[model samples]
Target: MLLDALVNTTDAVASTRSRLAKVEALAGLLAQLEPDEIAPAVGFLLGKPRQGRVGVGWRGLSAAMGAPAAESSLTIADLDALLDRLAEASGAGSAGDRSRELGEFTALATEREQDFITRALLGDMRTGALEGVLTDAVARAADRPGDVVRRAAMLSGDLGETARLALTGTAEELDAVGLVVGRPVLPMLAATAASTSAALETTGEASVEYKLDGARIQVHRAGDEIRVFTRSLADITHRVPEVVEVVRNLPVRDVILDGETLSLDEDGAPRPFQETMSRFGADAARETVLHPWFFDILHVDGRDLLDEPLSTRLAELERVAGAHRIPGEVTADPEVAERVSRDAIEAGQEGVVVKAIGSPYAAGRRGSSWIKVKPVHTFDLVVLASEWGYGRRKGWLSNLHLGALDPTGEFGEPGGYVMVGKTFKGLTDELLRWQTEYFPQIEVRSSAGTVWVAPTTVVEIAIDGVQRSSRYPGGIALRFARVKRYRDDKPASEADTIQTLRALLRE
Candidate 1:
């Protein structure tokens, strides 16, 4: 298939607000793709190339641009092959090699294709074609059940692969996709609630476990060999040997555990989130040892517990995790849930996750079955732009332009960020310096005082809640918004949604 075909379909999808129309357009495009082209095409549409961050950035992309080709000739296979080469370019003189290759490739692309390729490479494709919509499109193109494709995608933690399977393989083959002990599945997500009581109301007879201020980890152990993956599914087993050793001593021979890992101070209190992440992202061993606390067990021995109720999974988690299990109690009483929440806060943890006792694990899905209640309103928001500092803080990028995700174009363009508020609060001199140095590297555009970035940075912001406002497109603004920290572990796509903040009006 030609690259123009995919680019035209993306344009159609982005130009419409109707989700059904977008899915139909994408499905039509998917139906025409060859089996081998499906994954790369899906990845490009989602703004994530299958090659994964080919060391290319906005600067690199801009440096390589040239005049466009008049007519379309580039094939999907050609683009994929180019990406493969770019991804492999590394070492002393790799930068020049990539520049040459990118320049050559861009010279053959038309204006629209050039824009699509650049956005796709930078993961800034605000095309309204989110993963869920594309998953539905894949199902439609392949004439497969939506649930089947979704399940396979969630289990495998790779939508591109799932798209290829749904389009090329049989329905039975897709259905046969199951939890493997070694492969990390997408971690289950949680909805937000105002209080423990509210969360319990959504999840009756729940396990109200402590919500830690730590990184999400999925540990897979197979006969003493353990692999640890972050929330994004990047393998970091070597960096966290302590976690590996801890999982290795588990009672079961093979297991898949979902949990959090954080460094603790001498008094055993959880350290600041940045401290934990600094240690977590290190490539070499660090003195700051991280401790793992398992909350749910998905696999034990040969039993798959994902289909089991939370009650069953927690039981298995407790048996296998033993002392490493996270603290919580199963209860239907609101008072008990509230006590757990209070206890978590007093222990310096975030809050409580009230999970339904009878609900099966819904990987990658944020449903009412599991709700998180934090006493303080904190959200993961994207940094849309940064403003130049003035007065005493001169020369630094001081105020942040924050945005909430609008995946369905409820308030604006689909798969776009809706600005909700701005804040220069809670930033230290160190943070300001980092922002000044980093924001320009990802710059998409700039005005007199503001530098618009690619909306790829996720920051944890604490607010006094939200208030209705006409100043922003989301119909709400964050109250007393301040940065808690930058969530380097999270993707901008996972930022809290405008609907989530808008719902605060009722409270």
Candidate 2:
């Protein structure tokens, strides 16, 4: 298929706020794609290239812009091949080679195609076709069940591969995409509640587990081999050998454990989040030893527990994890839940997560089955832009412009971020220096004092609450907002949404 066809479909998807319309447009395009082209096309539509980062940034992209072709002649295969070559470019002269290759590729694409490619490369595709919408479209195009396609996508942790399988492979093959011991599946996510009582109300007879302020790790063990993955499904096995050893000592021969790992001080108190992340990101061994705490077990001894209830999984986890199991209590009493929350906080944990005892693990989906409660109102928002600091903090990026996701375009462009507020508080000098050095690399444009970025950085912001305001496009402003930390472990697509913040007004 021609690249123009996919670009036109994305444009159509972005032009409408109706999700059905976007799905229909995407489905129509998906049906026309050849079996081999489905995966790359899906990746491009999702604003992520299958080749991953190709070392091409905004500056490199700008240098590559040239006169566009009058007509559309580039095929999807041609674009994928170009990206493959660009991804393979490395070594000393890789930058110049990438620029030259990008220039040649852009010269052959039409204006619309160029814009689409640019947005895709920058992870800024604003089409309303999010993964859920696109999954529906894929199912519609392939004449398969939506649940089947969704399960396949979630278990495989690859929507592109799921699309290829659903479109070209048999239904049995698609359904057969089960949990593998080493490959990481998408981690289950949680919704939020105001308090432990509120969370328990949503999940009756719940397991109120401590919500640790640490890095999420998914450990997979088969025989003696172990691997660790982050919340975003990035492999960090080599960086965390201690975690591997802990999982390696598990009683089961094969198991999949979901949990958190963090560095602790001599007093057994959790270290600062940045300290844990620094240790987690480093490949070399450090003095800080990270302790693994398992909360849920997905698979053990060839028994897949994902379809099992939380009660069952907890039983399995208790049997195998022993001292490594996260602290929690299974109770229906609201008072008991509140006590657990207090205990967790006093223990230097975040708060508590109330999970329904009978609820199955819903990977990649955030539902009310598991609800987290914390004292402070915190949200993972995207960094839309940043302004230059002044006075004593001069020459650094200090003020951060925050945005919330609008997946349905209720407040703005579909699958785009809507600016809600800005904050300069809570940033240390180190953070300011990091921001100054980082933002420009992903910058799309700049004004007199602000540099607009690609809205790809996810930062955790603590707020008193949100109030109705006309100052921002989202009709709400954050009250007393401050940065808690930068969530490098999370993605912008998974950040909290505008609708979520608007719901706070009711609270």
Candidate 3:
């Protein structure tokens, strides 16, 4: 397919607030696409090339333009390089003008250039928009599982392999076969039950494991090779050589285990999420102190135990893994798991994913399968147009703004659904860079260079809570609303309903 075709799909997806229509249009295109065209086509569909780890916004794109001509995976240094270029490109100096000229450079064809020119400036790579939504649009168009698309894209830095399978057949095909380099589809997540009775009501007969705050990772091994994937399903074997080294120590030749690659301090307790985040990209020296805490086992020696149920996987994982690899399994008792979660939080960990033993792995689905109970904090929201982040945060623009998801003078969209908030926190630097560049394409109106999006991104921010505000559009403000991370796995319809926030206010 022509790059223009994909770019048109992205333009519709990015501009219009109607996510379903965006998805339907893209899906129609995917139905007609060849497998080989999937990666670059989708890249165009997202309106930007996959710069890998250079960071997604202007910062990231700026760096790729100046990067040395070398074949390298995404790295933090790459982002810094991009940031340097972005600063120069946006500046008013002689070198800055040259950088701006570089910003206008394009490998796109003539027709493709016209469409992008009409969309936004500088190749329409403004952030404050959700790549996740665009990701969902692609998944929906291709008729593939959203997470599968995300994981594959994250894993291979290309979706050609999986997209080929999805277009030719079904999600099962992509799930059933692919190069081992790609990451596996992420399992869906469950919400935390506030009360014990609630927890019991939600998870009957299900065992619970400590909710670890450290990085959620999946370790897959085939033959003698090992690969580590983040919850997002991006392969980070090089980034986390330690995890790779640890998996190499596992006895089983072909096995897939789920766990946390916690960034530990000198004492061994889990480090803060920010500290752990500091290790993202590539940093061998800093990574030496990182630790991996094993949790779930999805596949054991090609058993495909995700369908066999969690209990069998756990037991087999323990027996096959022995004590040399994987973390010790804790009890199914909620109290025990809660204690573990508390310990993780107390030790500056993010929160834990309370999992039920014996449940089969539900790739790319979030429900009661595995629940995440983290400390609740509210963020001051600024409404950025609700669009998707990539991967799990595809639809609903779950990576939202915080000025408020509330009403503004009884105007637009029933309540306050305008683009007011923005964040790429909790997301890797690569994700952030993608958004920054993507934002301008869908720019609605607001600040000059900041590119005020349509105010649709309804992000779920983690902060202290509600506070008085006069500076923002919404009357109320988020206390510490920093983008915790993109809630890729959620739908906008399920975003923080007004009623939910009111209830919290009552509390």
Candidate 4:
């Protein structure tokens, strides 16, 4: 199939608000693809390339200029092969080679194709379609159960391959994509609750485990061989030799364990999250030794425990990891759950995760089987600017750029605000409309898509916590920030200060 066909389908998908319409459009497009073309097409429509990052960034692509093709001639196979070659470029002067290759490819692409290619390269197509939406579309196109397709995609760790099998292969093939000892599957995620009592009220009998403030690691061990993957399934086995050694020493010969890895101080308290992240990505000279705490088991000694309940999985995890298992208690009592959560916080941990004992591992999706309760931090911040919205929010000013007061001139000018982060979450349509009309009234300047506003608007912002940052002037940024409401009565002078956020870095 031609690349033009897939690009047109993606355009149609982005032009609608109804999810069912998007699924129907994508499913119709999938039905028309050849068996071999389905995989690459699926990847492209979902704003990802099967070849992964092609060594091209916005600067590289925007710098290269070429005349567009008068007609569409690039095939899906042709583009995929070009990307494969681009991914292979490396070593001395590989940048020039990649630029040359990208220049040639761009010359053959029309203007519309160039737009699609840019979005695909940046991994932000804004098509309102992602893995979850495409999974449903694939199921509808292949006449298969969505649950079966989702499970296969999660286990195989490749949505493109799963779509290919569902479209061209049999049901047995989909079922065969089970747990493999050395391959990583998507980790189960948790929903949030106000407290342990609220979470226990939802799930009668639960396992309350301490939530670690560290990086997520999925370790797979077979004999002496072990592979460690991140939450996004990127293989980082070589980065942390300490993790490999720990997994290899486990009692079980073959197993897939889900856990968190972090560096602990001499007192056995978890370090700051930045310290853990620093050790996780270091290529050599691993100074800060990371310790892995096993929380759940997916496969143990050739036994597939994905379909089993949380109780059975925890039992297997305990037997396999023993002392390495995460500390937790099984109870239906609200008081016990509250005590456990409080103890976790006192130990320098994040919070507690209350999980349903009878819930199976629902990978890749954020189901309600698990609940996380954590303490929230809220502050009154000033809105520095706002960016124009996209898709459904095209006309309104969305995505607020937040800033905190700097009284001591620690970051730039005295008595000015320093940008901490940006957030578009927790904004309703009413708030969007209000900002659209109100922000420009106090606009300091307006540009292509952003409007710089006066620092008079104080807004209440909630965050998970703060993290060390090099991009922000205060050397810290808000983690998971969202708008609570506009603090209309407050002034920018009374807003929270950078010192307040820096204090969280110590905690």
Per-model TM against the reference: 0.98, 0.98, 0.62, 0.77
Q: Give candidate 4 misplaced runs (Cα > 4 Å).
A: 377-507
| Over 4 Å off, model 3 | 1-4, 7-20, 32-35, 47-160, 168-183, 187-197, 320-351, 376-462, 466-507
Reference-based lDDT, residue 82, model 3: 39
Ten-residue region with minimum lDDT total, candidate 1: 313-322
Model 2, poorest ten-residue lDDT window? 243-252
Model 3, 249-285: lDDT tens digits are 8777787777776676677676655566557555464
Could you tell me the lDDT of residue 63 within candidate 4?
62
Q: lDDT (0-100) at residue 157 of candidate 2?
A: 95
Candidate 4 RMSD to the correct structure:
12.4
Residue 257, model 4: Cα distance from true site in angstroms: 0.2
Sorting all predicted structures by lDDT, with the top scorer first, yields: 2, 1, 4, 3
TM-score of predicted structure 1: 0.98
- The alpha-carbon deviation from the true structure for residue 384 of candidate 3, after best TM-score superposition, in angstroms, is 6.0
59-163, model 1: which lDDT tens digit per residue? 888999999999999999999999999999989999999999999999999998999888988788898888899999999999999999999999999999999
lDDT on C-alpha atoms for all candidate structures: 0.92, 0.92, 0.52, 0.84
Compared to the true structure, candidate 2 yields what TM-score?
0.98
Alpha-carbon lDDT of model 2: 0.92
Error of 4 at 60 (Å): 0.7
